[model samples]
Target: MYCEIEENWRDLDIRYLSFSNICKLNLLILDGERFPILLYDIPCALKVLHWTDCPMETLPFTDHQRYELVEIDLSHSKIVQLWDGKKVLKKLVHLNLSYCKELKEMPDLSGAPNLKTLDLDGCEELNYFHPSLAHHKSLVELNLSGCESLETLGDKLEMSSLERLDLKCCSSLRRLPEFGKCMKQLSILILKRTGIEELPTTLENLAGMSELDLTGLSWT
Candidate 1:
């Protein structure tokens, strides 16, 4: 059974909910709203937040709050830009900001040491993945597919744990990190439907690489 809060809500002014009851938020619906107001008044308890059609230009959150947040799914939101300098998400491990097409530039990721997987797929307007992302020394998987405006990767992409890289459909991507010399831990290199015509002669750089997936290439 499904319930809708906007249509059947008993109280219109409820502000806080316990972490276990987050599923109740799916029932609430607002028209063209700026993120759900479910827990706007509460602080540091909710860990996972998923917004459907929320038009948040900036996640106004800062470094002051000690949060237990882990997985954040903001896919297909109306966000335009954001860069958290303080890196408030100490527990954040997997972040999915896919298809938030308006975001222009990502912040210098010098503080997010625990982040492991970052999915920025279909974010076409996102041009630069800050080289400082290399600062996330623990990052293992990064997906930049459909980021048509992207042109480069970090100068150094060889983290000891870094493994999978998906750059499919990034049509405008021209420059790549020096693969044979810089990326030693990368294994699965996905370059589907991209503008790449050839793998760098130095493709041997990924010493442990197992599968090189170039699924769709106009030139290869």
Candidate 2:
């Protein structure tokens, strides 16, 4: 089953719904000004959760309940964090949190082993990344463009399958993590308008690199 609440509905309360009858629901798309305080009643079989402009700070589901989810897009929301601690999302593949200006924390991706795309563009408040991100081998595209508060990306990245990495406009970031030797499939790397002064020698490992944007970068 699929349900989509129109974006014009500014004051719809999810608490009044009968969740018991919607146990088999698979897709839910909500665009509203404010969301319910808790989302624990959402169906366990849900696969797609696209809630743009949501006002919630955190998601209220356990690891077991979110296991079936395949894609999640909470762009333009006010979420500071997704949930507490690490949650296993084995079936999750795509996650988009773009333009979530208040976002500061990221859950561990060690549990989401098959995750392919992660979009965090315009997340201005995010400064630190979860350690698990450095070793996520299944990620194909990772975008951190416009993350003005970001300073570093740990010491090294080991995502062998990553194809594109966008770090444009990260004004506070001065350095990049060393790319792993297995990252031969990386094709695009955007580093426009960042604080980085030098490139790591490991960059030579990306044999498939087709685009490397260095516009607005100042060399030391």
Candidate with the greatest TM-score versus the true structure = 2
Q: Write the per-residue lDDT of candidate 2 for residues 1-220, one digit (tens) a residue.
A: 8777775555866556544347788888776636463355456788988888888888877654555789999999999987778887888899999999999978888888999999999999998788899889899999999999999999998888999999999999999999888889899999999999999999998889999999999983
Return the lDDT, model 2, position 218: 95
Error of model 2, residue 26, in angstroms? 0.1
Each prediction's TM-score versus the true structure: 0.78, 0.92
Off by over 4 Å in 2: 7-13, 18-21, 63-66
Candidate 1: clashing pairs of residues: 180-205, 197-220
**Model 2 lDDT, residue 7, Cα:** 51
The sequence of per-residue lDDT tens digits that candidate 1 reaches over residues 12-65 is 553443333443332223333453453333235545555545576766564666
* lDDT of every model, 2 decimals: 0.68, 0.86
Model 1, residue 53: distance off in Å is 2.2
lDDT of 2 at 132: 92
